[model samples]
Target chain A: MSDPGKSSIPFISLITLFPALLLGTIFGIPHLIGEGSAEDLITLSGIGVTVTVTDLLFVIGLLLSASIMAVVYYVLVSKYKVAVLADSKTEELLKSRDFFLRLFDDSPVPYLMVAKDGEIVLPNKASQRLFQMTAEELMQYKFHELHDDAYFAQSRTIYDKFVRGVASSDVEFEVVRKDGVRRWVRLSALPYRKQGGKGKGGTISLLDITEQKAIDKVKTEFVSLASHQLRTPLSAMKWYGEMVLQGKEPLSEKQRRYVQKIYKGNQRMIELVDLLLSASRLEMGSFHIEITSFDPILIVKDIFEEVTKSIKDKRLHIIENYEGDHTNFFSDKKLVHMILQNLITNAVKYTNDDGTVRVSLTFSPDDLHVEVEDNGLGIPPEQQDKIFSKMFRADNARLKVADGNGLGLYIIKEAVESLGGEVGFTSELNRGTIFTVTIPNATEGSGTKSN
Target chain B: MVLQDTVLVIDDDNELRGVLQEALSDAGFEVLTAENGSVGLTVALESKPNLILLDLVMPVMDGWEFLERLHADAWGKGARVIILTNADDIDSLSRAIEGHGYEYLVKTDWKIDEVVDKIRGELGVQ
Candidate 1:
């Protein structure tokens, strides 16, 4: 098949006029030699016809020159158009480059382009504002110089790893301002490489998180103080009530009933105090896990027995599959107990009259999984996100029981997580909810799982 | 000469201390009570009870200080110390148990009778 472009337009091929000239010379020279050159003087014939050779030669030369000039004009104009197009493209690229440079300079976040050598390369106007120094002054110093001296060792190690293709570029760092005040900054970097795959420079954006850090510190302190102070007195209340209820003094029937009410009310107060303490410990990140090796199934059974009265009051059916040898995990007993208590209570409280509540324990070499599933008033899909949130109760749940502090799931989630386990639930409205907690069994070199 | 198993209750709460003293005495153990860690340490060293149920949060000297002082004395070493704490975190729990070789229990979680029972169990007494 012939090339499609080969037979297309010969007009643009006029730029190859050297070939055109070659053909013109080869063919014209032959024609001139064969036809002979028209030359000289005028001759008069008897019939009165006269002609000059110079006139005919001048006419022939004019036609040949016109043909060559047309091809030359086409070639010159096409080349000129190509040059203009290239120039326009260069101009567009320059405009875009300027726009992006201004955007970087004007961003609220401080931006700095850093070299693999830890040198501060290209710093924007915002970087100057953040560091309280001019670009010229900051440029001479290394990137880690802006960070607090305490961060030097770690920053150096991180930088070394980053360039060595081992570490992530995003990290939180502390920087001392020009005024000698420490500021928290979240530094995220975009690292790139050279064309040859060698590590190149990266750009970092610093977001000042000083205010956020301060707020977090205050929140932690408040939680720590409140939990300790509030629960101390409740312990006193609990013991005194239990003392009177179990005292050997003979009391009338009415008096005994009154004392029992007091004990129950005191018990409720203690439960509330415990809920608050759990919330505080979880929020302050001080919820301690003292893992002791114990049979998980035993703890589950004990929690079920503790909540038996509640189960009977609600008339809920109790289903237990706790048989055989479950795992003896090295885990925090108190935390696991709290988790089981919370989950079982939730199952009992949310379930309807005569609703089925099942407690199942399954074990493996690597992990132990405990699931508390109930055919309760299952949670709504929209409100599921708020289930683990503190003091959050579903609308249906609130209507059924008004006494719930709604900290049950929150405590369960925090306690289970403190044990280095995961807690998740599956629910359908008016059907049931199943909460599964999976904790890794520490049977190897590790002693106990604690947080 | 073997004697009756003696138990000491060191706690800040006047009511809880009184109640535990009454309960343990009823359980046929010689019950001794101290209001704070300062008096408790002295009493513990003097009486050398078989078991001591010490509450962690107390005035003057806390349970931790009492244990430190008790460990220093030769007589206090013979008694088995059990810290009954209201401190919620596990660090305090483990510190009370590991630091002094004491048994730890949460105050509200245990009934007054249960605390007495635990003391009796630790002492191998009725």
Candidate 2:
């Protein structure tokens, strides 16, 4: 309150000093009683006291001196108060700055403050630990020095993007530490403005995710090896089992049944392995979507020939409807075939004898929709929600069919979704289920997965 | 009469090789087996079989290498190759086909009797 221009105490002091001057009038009171004249008040300073108790000149001089002292006291007090206030304000600002600095230093996530010139402006405690160096030593090297040479350009681009607030949400890359070890780190960055400079910088935080990446890699490798190695033996068993049934001399009814059972068992194994392959690919997120233009009708015809005899023997009617047989779909042909195969296989497997399976395909400018409707034992209402869940089987589905592992719908769902499509169904118990999948036409547009 | 024609089975799986040899022989075609691609190539050159069933992914010379070597040989050029392989790598399979169109079969997808029938068809027999 005590900047000379800003202090309110000067006005209050002026008022208090004005009232003290009233004592000067008391000096005149003696004169007013006819003891002396007001003009004689100044003569007191020129001579010694004249022995009167109410000398006008003496009283006027005392009152004026006291008023001067009061003004001086008020100004000094206000100045002291202002100094105290400024001291505490500065202290509070310093404390908050210290708090943020400590937080950055103590954070477990490694942080690097990088200048636009690519120099390491500051390194936190975690960064020091990550790079196997002291903070001072870390700052001695540039940002790219802590990273592999292969990652320098990428790191620079990411830094620029981050400073501009345009980088991807999650950025992950590998870096070489000072200890000569490489590790993967997920990075997040924030822009930092220099206090009094035209330069801008970024503070990047790194979280080590090497262990998670390693685990994922091992899982993918194991799946690949199992699929590759298991197929050979399974192939042998299937071939031999089939050979026995196709022998020149026809076996008895009992022997034929046993051989047929073997063949069927092998087929189930193949189906399971293929399902595993798709599941692993989905989980690994490495399923490549190769969009090739092909006539889907030919695929349907092949599948039809494979299932025709069995459908006929069971007295079931199979119908294939195409609005335009010549209409070609631009999509991942293998995945589309898989989607069709799974839905149709489920239809054939779950339906009762003499049931009907109708497959109709509709075309749009942007997508193709295939609907597989079967009057099979449909899923109950409560179980419909979980039909696409892994290893989920309907109670009635299991009762009607005993050999299902419940991966068919899951694989179908994965394959369709990976192709940027949607698969959904509506079903009623003992009536029918209709599965319709809409896949975007890669012909008219671009998708995430194109080889 | 079918046994008059010889077939070479190039595969590393001993048990599968045994079963396939027995099946091919039962179908009346004489069968020769080798455990790896290199051994199979030597046997194939010496025997000069009527047909070759090449298995990919064998050690000491994979099916691709065997085919390359077979193409270089004068006697081997006339032999029809039927790739009986467990390798499911799509690019490799397609690339193998682009050079010389061979009827490739995924072993798991075909039965032994079916393999016999496919071989018979290639040989122009019933």
Candidate 3:
């Protein structure tokens, strides 16, 4: 026997080589038989030789088929790997697409994607609901489809500006819905561009502001109507009151007292009406202020002179404390008058007989601060906030005073704010209230002036 | 203060005008009345009244129009018009006195004697 390693190698090779060996044996046997055998083989060639040749051909064919199978296996495995990679890439793309779609769908504000030519490309669910249109229908339509012709034209202008990159933020507009419902919407848009500036598109967001617009409209109408109605009656009251007060007719003591009562009542009504009108104007941003450079001290002195008689009984003490060389500042003189009048009048109204009311004016380089301090029933903390509200009165003041309509402080606050000034107060129950007003100089046009 | 000096009351309210006439008569003055601004203007120009009580807010012609027309007329030059109006604001008062050249008196403050005294003052009666 050969060496152990060599013998083991042959055995292993034979196990793998059985088909090749069998094929070789069948074919080589005919050739090895020689001449006699060859003659016999020739005679039996049709059968034996054919069998040998067939066996050889089959062996060779099997070897060739194995080689072909190896090639096919390599090609199929590589193809499978490529297909798997392609599938995973497709799956990743689909996941990203779905994520963006979900984000667009879930956005709170109504969103619409429009092509460059104003065709609707996509609309979020909110957009569909707002316009009361189905997704399919909205995609087939444009923004003009839901608005009136006039508004549609306006929308085109705004959209054109957005396309040209001239406008960057949302613009407010009125648009009509498919159901003929008009609404106010704040529309914001972004220009969408594809790779290399090839494709252009726009995404628009619409915020419904109908409720706010309605509230403003109602406020304007109410102010107009109230002013007209209140002024008409106030005119009659003032005219008649003055006529009676002028002593045009002979009167007894009782008659004079009655006339005086009526006059006083009418005068109070006029004041109330004036305060109401002023407050309404303030809230509506229509209150007029004529800003000019004037001395705050002079204005305070003038106001004091005008209201001195009313507060004479209260022993009111008004002190002017102005800074040096800065007495002159820019401000609306009339508004200043009204502010001082309201504060001083309020002080007199709330102060007891013989109580003291002090008016002090303080100024700085950037601002003018006026403080009106009164020793009266101090405001309760709970009622402080409501004091600046129109037609609101403190409970204690309401119980004690007959002349106030709760509009004095409200008007004061409005007038102050309109002039770019601030009004605030400090009070302790049963102590006293001190109102402070800080206003910018007149050069800033803090007050509105009526033509 | 007598029949020679007639006081003209121009107002839109017929009831008010009638009451005014009666009150003026009792207060010892001859009174003439017109319901609208146009007719009141005609009456003022024709009668050459000692004093004219003009009411604003009339139907055909308002007090403003009447004042414009009356001020333009030669006969109405010397006539004193005490404006009977319901306007209370300083702007309206200023317009009446300065812009329209008239004295404004509110209706609610009206008294018979007061009206007569104003008329007497305008007429220069002692």
Best by lDDT: 2
Candidate with better TM-score, 2 vs 3: 2
**The TM-score obtained for chain B of candidate 1 when compared with the true chain B:** 0.89
Question: What interface RMSD does each of the candidate structures achieve?
Answer: 2.1, 2.0, 6.4
Q: Candidate 2: which docking quality band?
A: medium
Each model's Cα RMSD: 8.1, 9.2, 14.9
Write one digit per residue (lDDT tens) for candidate 2, span A1-451.
2355346555655655654466656765766678774445443455664534445444655677667767677677877687778878888989998999899999998988877654678899988888788988888876645666667876777656655544333477788887789888887766555554434766777888889999977987697679878988888888777767876677999999988988898898887887777776776666667777877778778777788776887788888888743475788888888888888888887778999999888776678889998989999998898999988999998888898889889988988878879999999899989999998888865444622
Answer with 1 or 3, whichever has the higher lDDT. Answer: 1
Model 1 C-alpha lDDT per residue in residues A299-356, reported as the tens digit of each score? 8778878888988887888888764346556667777788888998888888888899
Worst window of 10 by summed lDDT in candidate 2 chain A: A49-58
lDDT of 1 at A89: 80
Best by TM-score: 1
Rank order (by TM-score, best first): 1, 2, 3
Superposed model 2: Cα runs more than 4 Å off = A1-207, A248-255, A278-291, A297-326, A343-360, A370-438, A444-451
Instruction: Name the runs in model 3 displaced over 4 angstroms.
Output: A1-259, A283-288, A291-333, A352-354, A363-368, A440-451, B1-35, B48-56, B67-126
Candidate 2 — which pairs collide?
A239-B112
Alpha carbon lDDT at A188, candidate 3 = 75
